[model samples]
Target: MQKPLAYRMRPTSIETIVGQQHLVGPGKIIYRMVQAKMLSSMILYGPPGIGKTSIASAIAGSTKYAFRALNAAVNTKKELQIVAEEAKMSGTVILLLDEIHRLDKTKQDFLLPHLESGRIILIGATTENPYINISPAIRSRTQIFELEPLAAADIKTALKRALTDKENGLGHYSVTLTPQALAHYASATNGDLRSALNGLELAVLSTAPDPKTKTITIDLPIAEETLQKKAFSHDADGDAHYDVISAFQKSIRGSDTDAALHYMARLVEAGELVSLMRRLLVIAYEDIGMANLPACARTVNAVLAAEKLGLPEARIPLADAVIELCLSPKSNSGISAIDAALTDVQTGHSGEIPKNLKDAHYKGAEALGRGVDYQYPHNFKGDFVVQQYLPNNLKKKQYYEPKTNGKYEQAFKIQYEKLKKLLK
Candidate 1:
């Protein structure tokens, strides 16, 4: 029986691999390691279908080592022991452990000594963050490399290669993909080569050959049908969750509405409402600041409404809040101002308060010369009499640098500048 197209088209050499140039490109660490045929235990982590398994396979093929693949979800300790025994006889064995985060204590304990004694060279592949899922003992012994999603162009190149490789690909099928259909597959898979390849195979094999040309013709509609909604491999409890949220907040802070909406949709699809609400509230005050106080209030209300409504319905209000916050003027001045003040306090900036500024209403306060010449700001013009408010050590310190991003903050900057001159 023929294997799946994705499985058949897996790259067996470093040169054939696409994307993740940071690792596979010439002179890169992994490239060098492969070239030298000297590799230590390591973990490859990222979202699905970005060539983690292929890299492991390529490493074993290039080095001429005995390679065995096992899934932690299905394979047992007995299977691992078999591989360990084989390694003892063969000198060294490359074990490609998939879904390694699921490996239980028993399996982990069995593999620990083999890993330590250079018997099993473990290449752990995980869709989850190793730091959170893998045992610290295992993590400390391995270098972790994060494989990113392939770009559309990279996926396109791989697709072309697969279509023409006569020995292991769809070359014998006479499949013809239009440019539009090809682009649709490349982009619609959202960097998952597995999804793209599977969709391509489905489109080709399911369609009848055109009688005149005797060739399978794949068009945009067929491509769209095959590759449904872009596959999102976001695990709400994993690094992808935090990574997307971080990008979403930064996009809003950077005032990029499109990027903010993109990340927001990823979270929405993953049903991460609670985390979305919490992050939105934080970004509103931390990034938006006092630029538009009303915008901040609206975000809070939206979060409340989203919580009550829940998913499907909750996504609407959350999206509404995201759009508003992205368009709002951004300012980090508030955070900067507070942090500056905190630094002064933390660094021993405290000094005695002025005698006139001290409490004088107590019985003996007047005799002690406190409040002798305190100026009442309420009685002066603009309700802003010049007087020392900070401790002596920080008398001239100025924080709260206002931004002029929006009309509201423009007004603030003007007023703040005027007050600075008057007070000085």
Candidate 2:
């Protein structure tokens, strides 16, 4: 039996490689490095199926070095040392460590001494931000080449190659891809080449039973059926992190209790940590502002309870906070008011400070009538002195507009009324 399309279609040379032109294009840094045989210990940081491993293989094949591949997920420090010793015997060894970010600081430190000696040209791959996951010492020694997701056009080209190239491709199948079908496959894979090829292969194998007909057609619906379920909840990196959180925040903002709950469930079901959920809860206050002050308090309480209670049981406090935030009366611009005031001050929109509110220690300032008209709120009727506190240009600018239904609204209304009567 023939090998799978993903395996069969692996590029043997740099010329046959798909996508990632930014790294391997004519006159690119990687191209120049490969050509000069001046390759450094580097990290290939990117999403899956973007030719990281393939590039490493091509580099090994093109150069005069022995290639050694190991997965950090399965390999141990002892195994790494063994490989380093082997590289020392061999003139130059290109050690390709897949998912290198999985190594903890101690395990990663094992490679530093070997890398410093130039025994092995370390080529590592990771789906995460190296700055966050990789050890600082190891990271500083290796140059990082960021690989991007394959474009739709690149995926299309790959599909065409799989259909035509006879050596390892599915040329014998006589499959034809419609533009719509190609787009469906591309969109479904989200620039993952292996996934795209797997999806395409599945579509062809399932749909085309007879190769004698010499024609096969694939559509979005068929593609959807073949790729029935979304493999994982989140995309590579944290691309979906902000997206999921945004949806959660918006659901609460819109006061859709059910929607809020649903989004909360999605995050939890997707294996998002309770701590991240709590962090988002805190942001709900700053973003939601006085529109729902209870939201902020509830969020804080939920975080504290979650920390104390832990998971499963802790999920309850999180859900309660979400519901409370959704139901609470909303306001706007509480935090923004302070921000605007500060911006005004920085931009020179500020005028003279009220004498009573200013420093009282300045010599002769009090004698010059600075505090002559100042009225202390504590000494006035109802503790309500309606004095001008804003700079001259912003005196008429009302920053804190209270909502009509919340506790703050009631308090603000009462205070405003008493202050108006007292000042008059």
Candidate 3:
């Protein structure tokens, strides 16, 4: 059986790997490790099709070590044992274990000894974060290298190489890919080189050659059809779901409109209406708290409108709310005030309520002196009186410290100082 274009085009040397210059560039850790031929257990983690498997294979090729590739999602303990046995016979075996996140505990335990003994040089490839998914023991034992998405220029260079390589690519066939079609594939795939390469191959193979010239032509329409906008891996209930939401909230809180919008676009693309709406509401109250009352109300109204409209149309209202919240003045004084009060209550600092402030109309006899000293604040000017609201022991404690972030909070701060002096 013939291998797929991507598989066949795997870089056999470290120098040929297109992207991730941070790792595979000259004098980098991976480059140095491969050059020195001193291998160790490590994990290469990133998104799909950015050359995790190719890097592992290329490492083995460079060092001229025995290479074995296995899928951790399916391979059994017996299969690992065979590889381990082969490593014992052969000096060292470079094992490229893909989907290391799904590797069973039993297999992981079985491979620990070999890894420590330098018998098997383990190269685990995973798209998920190793810190989140891999076992702590394995994680501690391996050097973790994070790979980023490929740039458009890198993908373009790799595509051009494949187009002209006569051995494993579509170079032998008479094909013409216009510059527009090439740019479309490079950018539209969203940093996935595998998608770009596969789309290019499909565009060339599926198009009929012209009778006179016998050449396959790939234009913008063909490129668009072949590379139907790369679907992002946004599982609603998965790690990506929480990651994007966290980034979204942080961006809004940090007042970064561009980053906030990027995350919002991801949520909108994934149709995550409920999560986005809830996050926006929380940001309005939590981050934008007490800074601007009207802004908060507007955010609440926007959330309601989004909820009523549903997705596709809902994203617009939510985006409006997000931008408003991002640009608005930020203050967490409301949440901070409540948290301080809660802490006092939970940590035994809460004291008894003042007798004058207690409920006096609820079946209280006047003889008990419950309402004897209580004076109605309405009778005083500004509905204010010099009366103790907190217990005697906690009279000096202040909870709400309004910040001068927005106009409303600034006004509150000025009025609050005057009121504090008058009450005292």
Question: What TM-score does each of the candidates earn?
Answer: 0.65, 0.55, 0.62
Regions more than 4 Å wrong, model 2 = 1-3, 104-109, 210-214, 229-424
**What is the model-wide C-alpha lDDT for candidate 3?**
0.85
- Cα RMSD to the true fold for all candidates: 13.4, 11.8, 15.5
lDDT of 2 by residue, 4-65 (tens): 78877877666678988888887888788888888899999987888898888878877858
> CA shift at 395, candidate 3, in angstroms?
36
Two-way TM-score contest, 1 vs 2, winner: 1
Cα lDDT, all candidates: 0.85, 0.74, 0.85
User: In candidate 3, where is summed lDDT lowest over 10 consecutive residues?
Assistant: 230-239
lDDT of 1 by residue, 22-66 (tens): 998999988899899778899999888989998988888778899
> What lDDT is reached at residue 99 by model 3?
97
What is the TM-score of candidate 2?
0.55
RMSD of 1: 13.4
**Could you tell me how far off, in angstroms, the CA of residue 253 lies in candidate 3 after the best superposition?**
12
In candidate 2, how many Å is residue 4 off? Answer: 3.5
